[model samples]
Target chain A: MKAIGSFKGEPITDSDSLVDVEVPTPDLAEHDVLVEVKAVSVNPVDTKLRAGAPSQKEPLILGFDAVGIVVKTGSNTTKFSKGDRVWYSGTTKRPGSNEAYQAVDERLVAKAPRSLTDEAAAAMPLTSITAYELLFEKMGANFGQLANPGKTLLIVNGAGGVGSVLSQLAKWAGFTVIATASPANFDWLRANGVDQPIDYHDDLETQVQGLGHHFVDAAVILYDVPSYYDAVTKLVAPGGHIGAIVGTQAKLNMEQLKSKSLSLDWEYMFAKGDFDFRMETQGEALRQIAQLVDNNFVHTTLSRTIDSGLNAKNLREAHQVVEEGHVVGKVVVSGPFNGQVNE
Target chain B: MKAIGSFKGEPITDSDSLVDVEVPTPDLAEHDVLVEVKAVSVNPVDTKLRAGAPSQKEPLILGFDAVGIVVKTGSNTTKFSKGDRVWYSGTTKRPGSNEAYQAVDERLVAKAPRSLTDEAAAAMPLTSITAYELLFEKMGANFGQLANPGKTLLIVNGAGGVGSVLSQLAKWAGFTVIATASPANFDWLRANGVDQPIDYHDDLETQVQGLGHHFVDAAVILYDVPSYYDAVTKLVAPGGHIGAIVGTQAKLNMEQLKSKSLSLDWEYMFAKGDFDFRMETQGEALRQIAQLVDNNFVHTTLSRTIDSGLNAKNLREAHQVVEEGHVVGKVVVSGPFNGQVNE
Candidate 1:
């Protein structure tokens, strides 16, 4: 089997940062399904794990979002069968989707939207899963039946992968969306269902107040969280929520959140998969997302596609684009594995 | 009107820490009610404000929980009429309940429990409001009709004012309550509906794990939050909630909460009255609490009562007891104002 991975953490600029290798096929667990990966998206998690990977004897493959076909299933698998097309943002605790054929838990697999291409579908799973859990699970927002008409949500980094999908989900829930991005990406924000896009370089509190909202009902920081924590605490109304996806080693001034009775929701989608806590919900969330897509309630966020295939070169380019930190939606590497083994 | 208050922040041991003062009655707002305070409770908030009081010329009266008779009602008040017995944990933004006559928002007042004594009812309001909000509003625990069987709640400082009531509420919600307290207070914890009470002096993680639970479903820090942050973080299960009532100025290592995707819920019940976010909810919460009390679903946490009345001497003694931080439940002062004005 062909695989692209790293033995040690290195800068994306290095040629060996993401090199091709040949490995034996993985043995399936009872709940596993063997997927022939068709398309995979490069996300911040991919870049983060790649750059900070521990020095290990075995290569650490890193890709979470994938649109693939089920080639085989373990004896106990139930939801997926051989030849069924599936989509998932698999767990990083085990080997991920950056392989020719990968084994994943059936509980985390879902049917991809029939209305979109593999590359377009690949761009959404990881971000869509993250956005859904953060909004519905962590922040406690209603997704379908009831509408949050007067509710407002402020999305920091509204042009990034998660933000691009999160703002759309908030709009679907009938929330007045206030997002932050560069001036050039304001149109991109609006296209993604952002009601108002304020420049991140400007004062967020003043900008939100200028929009006639005293405080946002909810705020989610998809970008650098530590730097934006204080600014966000000030803009969220008392008894509101402030959610974050990024982890920070630095200690945050948690006192600022106490006065207003704010809840700091940390959404790490991988937690459920790694800890075996409600892993089935990931599949359910993806199914709901697919329904929304097929019905035109939401659209795919694939902005760029590497049509040359999922080679080491194309994967590195995708990683570099995501690492630059200004992507409007998502970048995907499509086609079959064409990486020539370095050996 | 007569009151017992502090001129500035001082050690509770000082004779002048709490002194008698005479002041004019406050002007009532459109929704304000003038109450004849019958009983008042001494909580951590009262002592905290006294210990950290700013340099102000006007004496700052510090008491939140009170059982009183509505002596007068404002023009727009609808919830309460003159002569109604009321119970309320008023806001710290205005003059508190330490005076003979105090003006409070009618929306923040509720009918006191018909079965309990004035002193007994006084011990509940402030702590009840805080605990109710922490469990139901912040942590999203099901109350009333739903019984959260098999769910577990860990309460730090179980023998204190908030912890005593919080454990009872958790028990009523069908949660197995694991509480932390001094070895001397274990019996008290049991009396207050704590399923298990561990010593705070020992390793909390090992103790909680020893009880056959790898993690608690929900955790609340009623004691010092900053010191207990990491230990509590480790004990909470993935996707669980960590609720805090105490405010922390020190920075907290938030990364510990990221891997589990936990939520840090800071419950400041006064935020509603302080910021005017949802003043009506306070009254509603108290109403539900009163029903629970009258129905014997829960009992009052008042363990000690100063029958010497709400004079400067009795008030100082109550403040000293709370400041020491080892009381079994709540310490309250009952009877009319007997403070001899310093003038």
Candidate 2:
């Protein structure tokens, strides 16, 4: 199998930062399905992992989101069959989707939406799963129903990958969506179902208050939580929730949330896969997300595509774009493998 | 009206720490219910507030738990009538419960259980409400049902006021309760429905794992959060919840909970009243708690009583006991008001 990997922590501009390599095809365990990778998306995690991860005996493959086809299944697998199309965000502890073939747990894989192309389907899984879990699981929003009608949500960095889908999901869940982004991306945010788009450069507290909401029912920070911690805390209603995907270096002032009896939740997409806790919920979430996508309730967040196909060079380019941190939605590298293979 | 209060932050042994004062009777608001105080319990919050609260033009009264008879009601009040017995944990923003007469919102008061004495009933409201909210609202357990059968809870400082009630509530909710206290309090803990009482003086993780539970579904820190954070985080099952009532002075490492998708919840009993967020729920919780107490499903945690009655001297002594921090359960001052009155 042909794959692109980073041998050591290095800047993306270095030619050897992400190099072509040959690794044996992964073996399937019980409940595993072998996936023939078709399309993959680049996220901020890829960039971070590529630049700072320790050099390993084997080069580290860095990718999480993929749309692929089931090539084979382990003896105990029941949810998927060979040739079935699927989409998922693979586990963090295992080899990722930046390869020609990968083995993923069947419980974490779901059927890809029939209404979208492989590139588009690949773009939705990671962000969709994250957004769904953040709203429903972490923040206590009801799933598959408008249970939170008239409630408000504040999404920081609303023009980014997770924010793009999260705003739509939160809106569909009957919450009034307030998102923050640059003025240049305001239209994009509004088009994606954001009820109010506040410029991130402005004073967030003042801008949110200008919209007549004294406090939001929930706040999701897609960016640095500490930088916006004070603002987010002040904007949260009593007994409300604040969720974050990005880890912070600064110590958090937990006392700020004490008076309101608020909750601080950390939503890491790989947690279930990493700890083997409720892994089937990922498949369930994806199945529902696929229905939402096919029903036109949600559209693909694929903002850019590397048409040159899945190769070391194209993936490197995608990583560089993600590292820049201002991409409107998602950047995917698609098509057949073009790197050298030893298998 | 005669009241006991502190004019300045001072040691409980100081003669002026808590003194008798005569003030005008409180005027009623639209939803106010005036109660003739009978008994009140001393909690750590009372001690902390009494010793650290700023001096005021009017002496600061510091009591939260009270059992009394309703003497009057405001125009819009409907929950209670004159002469009805009631129990409540009043709002922190109000004058509190250490007085002959108190004006509390009708929505925050509930009928006191007929099965228990005034002192016993008074010991319950604050801790019961805190325990109920921590389990059901904060940790997502179902209210009044054995919804979490076979699940486990770890309650730190299980002999304290909140812990004593929380252990019983968790048991009633069908969760296996694991509590930490000194070996001397093991009998008290077991009597309060703790299934496994580990010595807080020993290694917590080793003690918990030895009891055959690698992790708990929820962990509540009734004491210091930072001191128990590492053990609690490690002992919480994946996708579990950790709640704290006592605030931490140290900055929390929120990243430690990221890998397990754990939630850090702050449970302040006065939050709803402080922010006017769902104040009716406190009364609702108390109503259900009263039913539980009357049915003998849960019992009062009042371990000690001061026969000297509701006066400055007795309150100061109670404060001293709470400040010492080794009491088995709640310490309360009961009987009639024996102080000078303005009327």
Q: What RMSD, rounded to one decimal, does every model reach?
A: 2.4, 1.6
lDDT of 1 by residue, B9-88 (tens): 88988988999888878889999999999999998888988989888889998899999999888889888888999999
Model 2 spans with C-alpha error above 4 angstroms: A339-343, B339-343
Q: Choose the strongest candidate by TM-score.
A: 2
TM-score against truth, every candidate = 0.96, 0.97
Residue-pair clashes per prediction, in order, are: 0, 0
Residue B328 lDDT (model 1): 82
Q: Give the DockQ (C-alpha) for candidate 1.
A: 0.73
Q: Mind listing the fnat for each candidate?
A: 0.79, 0.69
lDDT of 2 by residue, B1-343 (tens): 8899888899999989999887788999999999999999998889888889887889898799999999999999989998999999999898989999999998999999999999889888999999998888887776665768889999999999899999998989899999999999999999999999999999889999999997788899998899999999999987788999998879777778887888898989899999888899999999999999999989999989996779999999999999998888888898888855443
TM-score of 1: 0.96
